[model samples]
Target: MKILSITTATNHLSVALNDDDQVISEKNEQDQRNHSEHLDPMIQDILTENRLSLQDIDRFAVAIGPGSYTGLRIGITTVKMFASILEKEVVGISTLKSLAKGIDQKDSLIIAMLDARNDNYFAGGYFGQALTNVIPDGHYHIDQLLEEIKKFSQENNIDQVVFVGSGIDKHDELVQKLGLNYTYGSESQNELHAGLIGKLAVNEEAIDPDKLLPRYLRRTQAEVDWHKRTGKPFAPDSDYVEEV
Candidate 1:
């Protein structure tokens, strides 16, 4: 089976092609806020270099966010269209889960985080050989996340905690204050990799094209502002209008 995967869930944009056993080609670049321009062409380049077409791909995979809202949209929308037109299987991988898979520390508490601004982070906790989630994925304040990690570690008797993802650098001091046996993820671990995403999705079930959507853990700032103005929940179907 052949799989094509795309990841725009972080500051990086990555495209990968995987044959039955391994990644054949991958294109990754740090293109913060320009997924629209880079993603499609990178996809085309990978396919072209490999001498394969969309018809040759047996499945499609994408990182379905808790990261950049716009980046997630760009990546998932592209997959939806391609899969729909080609009638191929499509699976969505959680960005946090993919980050966890990239961590090399075995049996250590893996805390994957993405910057959500204002001292809050999109974080999840995973551990052990299976990379099971100890803390469910969601948006959280730095202190709140640490508290849960501390509690979970003591309960599970996991001694080490490893922080991974692009957001880790911003919260170095806060992570350090936890005073556990801990380490920062490497640069490559901090960036998203479409190859890892494809591998993760290989055995997963595929959802219908129209049914797939980005997993934005919190409402957009515009969505929140709309509620403040009218005291009514923002309807997602309506066009978004940002208040000045």
Candidate 2:
């Protein structure tokens, strides 16, 4: 299947055209402030260069959250729009899973994380080449995440742990202190690769365009502040208004 995948879950923005599991073309740029501006152009460039149009794509895939709030929306919304318009199926790849898939490791626990700032992270653990979800993806404090990793490793008898994603650089010292044989992902494995996202989507069941949604593991600052002011608990479906 020909899949067009997009990743904008972090500062890095990447788009790829994949024929089955192989990457045909990819474009990546580091632009935290300009994903909105670059994403559409990158998609167009890849399709145009490959001599294909939106209708030629058999499937559309996008990283659906646990990263930049605005970035996730941009990518998910764009993919949804295209898929809906073209009447094609859409797959929402997890940002954390995409990071895990980039790592070429087996027989070790892979922890994929994105720094959520203030010593917190969005983390998930995967095992082996099939990327089994050993650790459920969620927002976690540094201490809590480490403890969970230690407990899981001990229980499963997994010897080494591989950590990947934007979260590694900031928490390297803390992760090292865990006393487990662990290694940080290489430069290439740390960033979200759109090609990997496309490949991972190959076996996943595609859903309607409207079913694809951003999976932000935490509440936005706006929602937090709103709760503080009104003393009301914020829920995912809460109708909190964002101030412009």
Candidate 3:
């Protein structure tokens, strides 16, 4: 099966074309400001280089969120549109899970996280080669995540904890303070890799394009400000428009 996967959940944007287990072509760069402009062109470049078209793709996969709000929307919207128009299978892969898969550690706790700023993170924990979900994915403070990791590690008799994703860069010192045997992922492991996303989608069940949505773990700044101004909970689909 030919799978086209996209990852734009962070500053790093990546696109991959995979044929079954083989990655045919991939293009990636660090461009946080212009993901919308680069994503489609990268996709086209890969397809054209392979002598294929969008119609030839059998499945579409995308990183769903817990990163940049705008980046997530752009990637999900583009993939959904293509899948809907082509009537192809669509898979939404978790950004954290993709990071976890990038790490090749066995018999240890694998924690995949994205820096959510202000000492908080979007984190999920997995174990072993199958990437068993030991810690649920969600927004968490650095201290809270550390406590959970320590508890899970002690209780499960696991000695080492492997941390992956951009979050490691910020919280490694705090993780070290716990006095546990922990390691940080490599520079490449920290970046979002669309090839891993495609491999993960191969076994996952496909969902309708209409049902696909960005998995933003927290409310946007705009929503928070709106709530504070009106003293009412902000709904994403609410009938509120700001006049230009």
Candidate 4:
């Protein structure tokens, strides 16, 4: 099965083409440009160089959210559009999971974090050979996350752990201060290769493209700002708003 994957979920916009579990072609950009323009053409180029087309693809994959809103929207929309026309299956991979995949170790408790501003992060803990199950999802401050980490390790007796992601440096001081058992992802979490995205989605089905949606783990910035100014987010057009 050939799978195409995109990682517009972070600063690094990466794409990859995989044929039967092996990487055939890939592209990655850490630029600030909007993904709307870059994503499609990159896919086209990769396909062209490989002498392939949309018809040759068996599945589509994307890095779902807890990341840049624009990136996530662009990635989800683009993949969904192609999947719809081509009638292909799509899989949504987590940004954290993709980070965890980059690591080559297993004994360490994998702590994957993405900076979410305001001392909060999109973070999760995974501990296993393949990161089977280490923790739940949470929007957490660095302190709160560390607290949970300490508690879980005490109970499970897991001491070897590594933290991966671009957000790690944001809390570098704390991580160093605690002398926690950790190491950053290779390439500094800069290369979010789409190969990993496809790697994680191999078993999933290429379902109704319409069923695909971004895993928006939090509200958009505009929504959050509006809530702060008006004491509520965008109100739905309910009966309360429609009354004459």
Candidate 5:
């Protein structure tokens, strides 16, 4: 089976093509947010380098995110469009889950965190290779996240955790203040990788292209502002109003 995966859920954009044997091609650009500008060219480069086309892929995988909203839209839309055009299977994998899969720590808690700004983050906690969710994935304040981590660790008697993603740098000092043993994920692991996303999506059930959506955990700024102006509570997960 051949899988082509794209990840633009963070500041980085990564693309990978994998066959039954191994990853054939993988490309990454860090500190770049122009996913709409660069993603197509990057995909073409990866496919051309591998002597394959979009039609050659058996499955399409995308990191449907809790990262950058614009990035997620671009990636998910691109993947869905490809799947729609080719009538191929498409799998949407969580950005946090993919980040956790990049960590190879044995029997340790894996915490995936991506910054959401304003002292908030998109976070998930997985334990060991089983990928158990210790703390649920969602937008969280730093203190709330820390409290949950503490509760889970104390309850499970786990001493340390394996932390990964760009949010690690943003909360390094705060995490350290917890006085719990923890290790920072390697620099290579901090960035999103499409190969890892592809591997995780291998056995996932494919959905219709139209059903795929980016997992934005919080309300967009415009939506939040609208609620403030209208005296309506900002409910992100509820039915969204079409922006005019």
Candidate 6:
């Protein structure tokens, strides 16, 4: 299968093109908040280098986030647009899951966090490759998430959970302050990775191309304003607002 995937659910943005045997091309950027500017050229370069057109792609896999709202939107929206035109299968890989894979936390309870700003984060938990407790991919103060993590850890007797993503840096010192056993990882080891996302996504059954989406944990300021303008308490449990 000629699979292509894009992931920008963290500070780093990465794209990958892979074949049934192995990856054929890949691109990534670490400059913070550069997805908007760099994503297009990066995708173009990858495709040009591989000598493949969008029509050649067999599957479209994307990191459906718990990361930057804008970045997640760009990643999913672009993929959805292309896939819709090409009628390709679409796969949604959770941003937290991709972060977990980056750290190879197959044996440990994994907590993947991406900064959601204002001292809040988009966080979720995985119990040894199985998603045990997910926060509905919502936003919460770090402390609130930490409390839940503590409770979950105690109940499961999880000694040391591996943490990754840009969010952890915000609470690194506090993690030690809380006396939590943890380790820090580099950007390459923490952020959502397209190579892994694409490969993993291909194993799943395809969903409607239009159903492809971003898991933005909280409402964007614009969304809030639109909701306020109309009079609706934004759906708390949902992550996406269908594009009009």
Model 5: what TM-score? Answer: 0.90
lDDT of 4 at 32: 81
lDDT tens digits by residue: candidate 2, 18-132:
9999999989899964899888889999989999999999999999977888998999999999999999989999899999998877788999998877878889999987998
Q: What's the TM-score of each model vs. the native?
A: 0.92, 0.92, 0.92, 0.87, 0.90, 0.84
lDDT of 1 by residue, 93-194 (tens): 889989998987868999988887777888899988778888988888888889999999889887799999756667778777877889888988888889
Error of 3 at 123 (Å): 1.0
Candidate 1 lDDT for residue 138: 86
- Lowest lDDT 10-residue stretch of candidate 1: 235-244
lDDT of 1 at 150: 92
Taken over the whole model, the C-alpha lDDT of each candidate is 0.86, 0.87, 0.87, 0.77, 0.84, 0.76
- Residue pairs with backbone overlap in model 5: none
Which ranges in model 1 have alpha carbons more than 4 Å from their true place? 234-244
Any idea what lDDT model 2 has? 0.87
Deviation of model 2 at 171, angstroms: 3.7
- Stretches of model 5 off by over 4 angstroms after superposition: 169-173, 229-244
Is candidate 1 or 3 superior in lDDT?
3
lDDT string, candidate 3, 1-244, tens digits: 9999999899899999998758888899988548988998999999999999999999999999777878989999999999999999999999999999888886879899998778788899999878888898888888988999999988888889888987566655777787788888899998999999998998989999999988887777777778789998667674222211
Model 4: lDDT of residue 73: 82
Candidate 6 lDDT score at position 228: 78
lDDT of 5 by residue, 128-177 (tens): 76687778778888898888888898898888888888666667788888
Candidate numbers sorted by lDDT from highest down: 2, 3, 1, 5, 4, 6
Tens digit per residue, CA lDDT, model 6, 129-192: 5555544455668888788778877776776778877657766777776566777667577756
